[model samples]
Target: MGAARVTRRGFLLGGAALLALPGTALAATAPEIADCAAWGARPNSRVVNVVVQRPVKILVHHTATPNVTDLSRGAADALARGIQNFHMDRRGWLDSGQHFTISRGGFVLEGRHRSLEALRNGRKQVEGAHCTGQNLVSIGIENEGTYMDTEPTGVLWDRLREMCAYICGQYGIAPTEIYGHRDFKDTLCPGDVLYGMLPRLRGEVGGMLGQRLEGSSVRAASWPVLREDDRGPVVEAAQRLLRGAGRTEVAVDGTFSAAMAESVRVFQAEHATEEVNGIIGGESWPLLAAPVQAGDGGEAAEAVETLAATSSTRPPSRVGPEQWQQLLTAAR
Candidate 1:
């Protein structure tokens, strides 16, 4: 109806300038500022004012339901600001509802300034609200979504994995600490399809943490090989994978046999990894094992081969300079 006040150039300038912050180096690359200026705005600007009353223990959230497709790098930043404005201006809240916000395009933005720093110290600090009661001890993360009955984009799922792992590691929060906003309240805020992936979300986060702990990147650690006598974890991993893939009917005995080796070969061929040799060597170790994801409601895990099929996104080898600036600038 009216001319959009924020210009793309303005967002670009804003995005470039954010790289100067102290925490930019540690955080992931942000979306383009120009992108942030274009997304649809939130309704009812009632800002809620509140105090950081307690230490954060977890992050919760719902999809804010902003309808748009073709989300550029900038939309993520725009969503963060819009949401912050909504919570502060519309909801009469002090700041954004969550400490982190993931855009539809998989961009992650910092809502509160001190959140990352506080999380790094693993000390008590106040995070924003997404879930009530738990808000006193949790960091809320609202994605640009309406999860009523829809599946989240692949990008959203990946970004959530990155954010969850980063926060959990920095704050000493476990995967069990991760929960959907509905888990605490009656509202199905995050929606069913997106929420249904919580178990996977937890696993992704756990997979991330395991990588950090194991001295590898997320992708690298997903399938790790045992160097020596650590065959127990590897053997167990292979058996589990074969069983999960429905290729072998092997018992959970911690021994590697020809049948297990054949299963591994089949899995390698399927994943397009090097053709599986009978020997489960270093190259084959990662394939045999499954990384742990945060379990949901105690359902038995789907098995290693199944996990390999599910965990498809690859980790970026190196962080680019321009992308880094975008992420820092998007932090509200």
Candidate 2:
């Protein structure tokens, strides 16, 4: 099959350029997707307390269960209801745990009503509870069926790819931005088989956006001097960017490790224009940084501005000095 082509302008609009047969293939803004009305409305829905002062970075998730079934709009609605119940009744969340839900039949349902609203306006708002601290910058998406028992269906793959491309384009997130839930937490939420598609998924999304591979999103940013307090901000930023860049293997715990080192190596090798010494040196640091550039013709610049302002005004309450040191050492 021929590769998909995505335009930078289209990416900025959160649109995807998908290729494939009409029935089997789908694009991000595909009209086939049912509206919120398709899925029953949340009874007594109330606004949540959490404040999202920024846009989303990565889309995290799970398989929900191993119950694979035929793709249908009804099945998708059922999954949405189940999700609403689980999040509200069990998790004590105001709404569903994810921003979107993909049924076995490839039906995509919006979880939080405001989620789509946020995406549409281009304002960076937090989605739902996928990762703990990182949830502030990530959007959680749950896919039906455990890929372990059976491979994801063509519908699911096509839909997921389209959605990923859409989200990436909308937020100026490179294909490297999409991720599995396990990438941040210490759990197998997305399952092994599905997680395995992470790399290729990112590449496919990038292809749709017409962007070359940006390589691993994780790893340490190179800094010549590691001040005691520098680790927290720098490492957290790197972890977030790596996930957004589609290097979903690293944890955002602020601890740099061998895996991070490996990611740095891979990123450098892929870029070719940089040194592949596994160091987040000054030269490599800027490239690894997200929000692209201040004046670049991309959404990355706007995101960078948002992140800088947010981080400066409010420090991440979770990261610690020890974690920062580990991250600094690993990147070096």
Candidate 3:
């Protein structure tokens, strides 16, 4: 709606001004990106939220589109336009939900409208809807194709590594900070094959950035985000913890309701400084929960058993040796 906002990296002048200017070397090193206009996106009618803080992490997603044989640039452009249409018309988003996308043909394209300009400047970020809770604070890159079983083509892999390196370098994010969609949500998105490659992806990105990630950082964990209207065994697990924390109003029935929300607020009030929004995340999760194991009993054991009964595909749903403590602290 307005002239491209001036950025700290210099007057953007235009896209062709990517040559490394004095004091703007980092800005010049951004990977080539086709902006929304290049792919014929609709006019973004809604306000796009911008943040001054650099994103702390990169999230990888797969389009879940069929693994088609067409690897042409035209197909990539068409894919971008199709995604934008679906996001705006079907999903009711302002524009595309993700910050960027990489086609199977290795064409890197900007998803959200201003993402390319922001990435070039590296001082601002476009808040996205790519992931539920962490969208405002992280960059999401959707790689085209469902990698549930098959590996991505070598060209696509090379482009992914380059794009990740550029984003990490510009944002000052650690290579180990890269993660898959499933890390924050309870979905098989990005597929098992792609999700499994995250550690190796991190290591390779680290190599490109000259930063070696240790095994611990490589194995870093983030708990699932339980939002409104969502239901699962994990919700039941959290409900048990809420009951132990003295919010008896929360029913351990594997459903997220207003009562469970109220209980979550009270729990946060007691153990955390977070806003009483009833959302459970890293900040409150560790503070409310302690450690639970196979021998552990009481509400904590029941919580673990409930989560353990969740889908067998998810490793966390299993009551393994290192069962995350969900109710021990509250039960105390």
Cα RMSD (angstroms) for every candidate in the order listed: 17.2, 15.2, 9.3
Candidate 3, residue 54: how far the Cα is off, in Å: 0.7
| Model 1 bad stretches (over 4 Å) | 1-57, 211-332
Judged by whole-model lDDT over C-alpha atoms, candidate 3 comes out at 0.73
Per-residue lDDT value at 28 in model 1? 29
Name the better of 2 and 3 by TM-score: 3
**Residue-by-residue lDDT tens digits, candidate 1, 47-86:** 3333434343454465556556968766666667767676
Query: Is 1 or 2 the stronger prediction by lDDT?
Result: 2
User: Best by lDDT, which number?
Assistant: 3
In the range 32-82, model 3's lDDT, one tens digit per residue, is 678888888888879899888889999999999998789988999999999
Regions of candidate 3 where Cα sits further than 4 Å from its true position: 1-29, 222-296, 302-332
What residue pairs are clashing in model 3?
none
Give the Å shift of residue 185 in candidate 2.
0.7
lDDT per residue for candidate 2 within 89-151, as digits (tens), equals 887887776777778788777776666656544445644765665666876777888765456
Q: How well does candidate 3 match the true structure in TM-score terms?
A: 0.66
- Per-candidate TM-scores read 0.47, 0.56, 0.66
